[model samples]
Target: MRALRTGPLLAATVATIGVFLSLTGCSVAGDDRPVVMVSTNILGDVVGELVGDEAEVVTLMKPNADPHSFEISAQEGARLRSADLVVSNGLRLEEGLQQHLDAASAENVPSFVAGDAIEVLDYSEGDAAGNPDSHFWTDPARMIAVVDALEPVLAGLDGADSTVISERTADYRAQLETLDDEMSTAFAAIPDERRALVTNHHVFGYLADRFDFAVVGAVIPGGTTLAAPSASDLSDLVDAVDSSGVRTIFAESSSPDRLVQALASEADISVDVVQLYTESLSDADGGAPDYLTMMRVNAERIATGLST
Candidate 1:
């Protein structure tokens, strides 16, 4: 068994990683087909595109696992320890697995936080660095930041196979750009009056900002699923859904929709809790098997929900 010890540079890096992980998840892997452990399924999809068969990827959080509520199992701890590298989305989105990341760092393995690559949106009254809006992928443009981070890291890792990594990353990035255009066109079709979105929570702020939609409110009310909505919060959201003229409330495929439903009923608003793949992609057999497919599906759902 490999022992866990950290040198000064690695120590500092890990400490910095912890801060970002507090805001979201982090990931890392090795040069010769890194054993990449990502915090969420969505991230796994993106990494899959870059690493392809070169890396053995494991996503701890399942399709429906709540990022905040997900707990790493004892077996998963072993996996983290054994991984050659780890890659996670930085920013406190994966509240559940930060501890495991810490453990991996203690093992002197380098871990990465993808969110640190992008300029974060600070939604709080203060804290200019950003108040942890972990759902940046909702905006395809912001995801370009993720892909940018992804390409270089992947290139460095697969030195011998660097050509393939660079080419594939470029191709994937181009596709992301095309998807961004498609989303823009699809969203443009939504009437301005109906462009306001009411979702399960504030996951779509970046997406709304990207496509010119106003994010009214969320059913759960925050970035992580750690906090459930209070009765007042639900009532207020239902009222906001009514006042904002958003006839539908978007539900993340990963989170619960019952509360959103009850709130809509209480408000007597014709709110439809439409499911969209957000944090996690659909299962392998499902339509959204990768990051591109996942984002496209969400855009389609959002466009259709808002239009109809």
Candidate 2:
């Protein structure tokens, strides 16, 4: 069973590292908007609010792309090289793109690590790699840090538009406050005993802490999906679910849900697999189109799902 888990993740890691690195360059020829590239779709959404058609914010990773395993193209390198500013979640979330970010910095491209605004969960990716958990946006209060960090960076970009950036950021920050308030109210509806979460990976430590749910366990058994679970790990998780009385194992839409479904069969327990946005945001029409709506949708699902 250990081999069942480890084999695929290892293969995924190798396959990922094998891809041609995304391109980098210094020219945005034939481009009209001020070039800005955001590492994740989640950050891209927030950036869009501050800039609001004033700039073309490049979202490098698409919706549902696993931050750990996303591939990049040479066009992306050109975008990075030409970007006036680069916004990233940082904390090693971009496994393949980290060095590219460093390159941009060395070239004196203005960049900001969005995660710097929040308290981060640090973890070793495995024995060989050291990486932080890098999922701080799960907690909206901590996410204020992302907005705070964006202000100075945006201001630095627009001396003429400092007032504009400040006003936009201030407005967006208030909206975030509202979103956090909504999440708190929604989470407050659930009972204490039923408010336990078992997810694909350790993505929600901050969310669990903020909204009063206990992170009973994770499917990966480690900090990341990059790490595979042993048979023992699966067995331990099964035991945790059974003992904790959590009727659900939340899965992300990005990855295969078969493993969790299979684990449920083996454990002889009935469980509902609830889907949630963990790593990416939906397109404009989906339940979690942007960060605020994503959290709102998740809070509703979590609160209602657990309280049942």
The numbered model that scores best in lDDT is 2
Position 102, candidate 1: lDDT: 85
Write the residue-wise lDDT of candidate 2 on 1-308 in tens digits: 99999999999987776652322122334345567899988898998888775677788988877887786788787669778998888777787687778878888888888777777766433322345668888898887878887877776664226777788989999999999999988888888889898887778878877777788887786665677777887888889888998888888876677777877776787888888898889777777888888887888888878877
Give the number of the best model, judged by TM-score.
2
**Which residue runs of candidate 2 sit more than 4 Å off their true CA positions?**
1-33, 123-131, 158-160
Q: lDDT of candidate 2 vs native?
A: 0.79
Q: Residue 284 deviation, candidate 2, in Å?
A: 2.5
Clashing pairs in 2: 23-74, 23-77, 24-77, 25-81
What TM-scores do the predictions have?
0.83, 0.84
Error of 2 at 68 (Å): 1.2
- Deviation (Å) of 42 in candidate 1: 0.9
Worst 10 residues of 2 by lDDT: 20-29
